[model samples]
Target: MTEIYQKLENIVKKEFISNSLIVRHAYSRVVDPVLQGIPDIVIRPKDAKEISEILKVANEENIPVIPRGGGDDEFGGSKPIGDGGIVLDMKRMDNVLKLDEDNLIVTVEAGISWGKLDEYLCHYGLYTGCMGPGSGMTASVGGGISHQSVGGGGCAKYGACTNQLVSLEVVLPNGDIIETGSQANKFSKIPFNRFGNGPDLAGLFCGDNGIMGVKTKVSLQVFPRPPFAAYKTFLLPRKDRQVSSQIMLDVRRKGIDVYDLMYIMDLIMRVGCDQGMFPMWEQLKKKRGIIFYTVEANSEAELQEKVKQLDTIILDNKCEALGPEISDGNIAKWHYVEQGHWQFYHNLWGMVPALEPLSCECFVPANMYPTILDDIDQWDMEHAKDMEIFTKVTGMRPITGSGPIFLIDGNNVELTCGFTSFPSYYNGENHEGWDELNLKLWKSLMGMLTTKWGVQWYMMGEMASRIMAQLDAYLPDYYKTLKAIKKVLDPKNILSRGKFEFWGDGNK
Candidate 1:
């Protein structure tokens, strides 16, 4: 074994550290349809101190380190940008530390999956307000926080998962351990609030995409499950995008506290139904776009009032209501009552055999999404030639459009926008130049989305993060300030090196 491997093995058990090719290959990519990096070693540290020790070795050796959670991100966030780095697999640290019912905060090992955490919380009649990304079934809490994730459920009321953060135990790139929020006061007994104690240092790690630090522990506010709830689904009239946007605007203007509000475009409905993916909507006559809402209240009377107001807004927008049963297309009910949040978000992915998604999930203003969707249709047409490459191999071109548009805080909505295409290696044949074409066309789409629509992306993994920098999206002063902070925190740029071009610039 090499000297660096020996040092890491000293920090963690031998079984948890592996430099084997099989193990390194497994940690190389996430959910995306690309191989991001083959790490030199993959190590699972059980706590902040172990992570600190492992990072210390990496800093001393000037080796890159990437912290990986559940590896569910569609972007290549968890994987290194290139070969030869340490993949800090945090999965072994999964554990619930505390549940302070009085403070309504739950502290957990950052590597714990949202599914596991929610299952634990459910036993106590509480849940993380934003159930986390749609992949919450396996997506880690740390990954959600790192991406400012949303779309699992309750985002309309709770916003992104990061909004519920109370504190964090993060290991800086240089192997220094620190606590944020109230815990920053060493005398504090338990984690309480996220603001105040300093300038919300916890915010730096949240959505940092593992670039700022490795989140070892997380404290998030939990909520009691509201007693009274109502859910409904509606099929929109013509001009679905505009109508859906209007419905959300009216819902916000009316000040209705909806647990979830979502718009599924016509393309997804038509395609999904054809593929037998959305059985709930298979009975619809028009196969048009659909909008749904779920509301929660402490009292039956209040619940009825919110439902009535929301129903009026939906009907006034010329939407036809589906029956009240799940079999009758009430996806809203399944999504809210049956915990379908984990299963329902990725309706477009793998809709066809061998198809995978190359998408961007981000936030856009409610009013601006309709125009952006229109532009996406235009974008698809513009790239017809490039798409022909896929058509030639698979007998059909890629499907490009937004998947689900969800209403979050304010007038903003979360949009999973992009296309699904077959990877180059399909059915054991390596289609030459397929990967290059995929990157070219994908980057072009990213450029259009960033420059034209100005959408704020949350999943800034290897692809989107580098594209943002390559596109010169950040203002000079803004980029400079970020670099300065990074330099001070990580002088050697040891953690998540090459992200946003934040290589070893400290020495410069």
Candidate 2:
């Protein structure tokens, strides 16, 4: 153990206590950066060789390891559970390898932040061209690929990070390095699209939340900057949310162009934004209990055309326009979100409770969206309490590229609702009245989604394991085969453990 620590210290080059502190803290606790659970040791490798040497030792010792990057992942991606294992901090490996402008692709070390890549590409007038969280800030290329982080900016153009991936250099459990695709090539590259051939490995790491192996280097496709952007707002008159939601669906069903960034702000979000703290929500409440929209177009002419159709749909649905629209306001409200005002989007709720689970998220078709979410909400109201939802990606694939639109993506639009269930005792109603009862009701309602409506939960978390059992009866042989491949790639079970477990131990 002394020898291991010495070697780790050498790799990280810490000659004193202060130097050791650099290796101790993870960015997850940045606000409380000096709090509990400091890492046993931090190994910062400048290259993959140094990583292999450290990993070999850790493996031989049977010590657990945590891979880290930008120190984000709201789901707690970078947190370590090691009894006394080391953190293989990847940030030191940061390097931009190649930028193929002609191919619209860029390659970089796993530690390179999204913002760094964006700045590098922008010099040449290009980008990874995906809807992602905070391209101007720090987020490793590998971490982005791992979480499949999708945000507002690129939803209309690039989709998720997986869609932009052209190739990767992955180091498997045995420390064997293998390339997945060409420098800028994929298995499914047609005249216009790139597809993963022979079992798309990108999907394996994309959103795996780093349970398999540490990502070393990645190659991704970029895009040219678009010209002309606009935001439009509307007020659905129907105090009945169902009526308004159905109307929104109707507009999409007719194949009319709509907002790239779209959603229905609930009363909680309505109330929170109304406090004048969140500018977006404040502007949004103008259309109380109504639909608000922001549209992006190629030019002014196309913009006017889409708006004309939107106006027609609004009038037909008995919804009316609100005063002081987004076009007039420059739609600066979205920045509140990009700048980390998520609570604004949460309706009236504050920080989302850790243990809160609503009913199953069912991605019913757009036609069924209003009715489905509304019915679910009513069930929770009468049967339990309040709700929250994210509805989109029915037939209207506003996200133009490939990958998951709805974890609820088959026959439905994906929506989620939760009743507040705070972990600790707070001053007043941390979880009083409806909040307390809803926790119990949320459980029963979820069961109903599975047995009754066949509603699904996005398989991005611990719940995925439960779904896998139910799916085995319905899954094809290929899925079993994929599980086998997962076992081989991650023999030690060192990857996104339990979160998105792709392996079945009994199978082996």
Write one digit per residue (lDDT tens) for candidate 2, span 1-508. 6777776566546642122565575422321111123556666677666666666666665555667777644333464532245666788778888776677777789888776777677788676665344332666777778766554244433445677877676666556666664322535442122344456665666666666667888878788755554444455564535555565566656665443333444453353344453454454435354344445567889877877776677677776555553333323234222333122223222333232223233343545555555555566456421222111111111100011122111223434443433322333423334334443454555554555555544323333333444444225676577567667876665543433335432211
Candidate 1 Cα misplacement greater than 4 A, ranges? 504-508
Clashes of each: 0, 18
List candidate 2 stretches off by more than 4 Å.
10-12, 15-39, 81-84, 92-95, 119-124, 134-139, 183-199, 239-259, 280-287, 290-292, 323-372, 375-421, 425-482, 500-508
Task: Tell me the whole-model lDDT of each prediction, alpha carbons only.
Answer: 0.89, 0.51
Please give the lDDT score at residue 326 for candidate 1. Answer: 96
TM-score for each predicted model, relative to the true structure: 0.98, 0.71
lDDT of 1 by residue, 425-450 (tens): 98899898887787787888889999
Top-scoring candidate (TM-score): 1
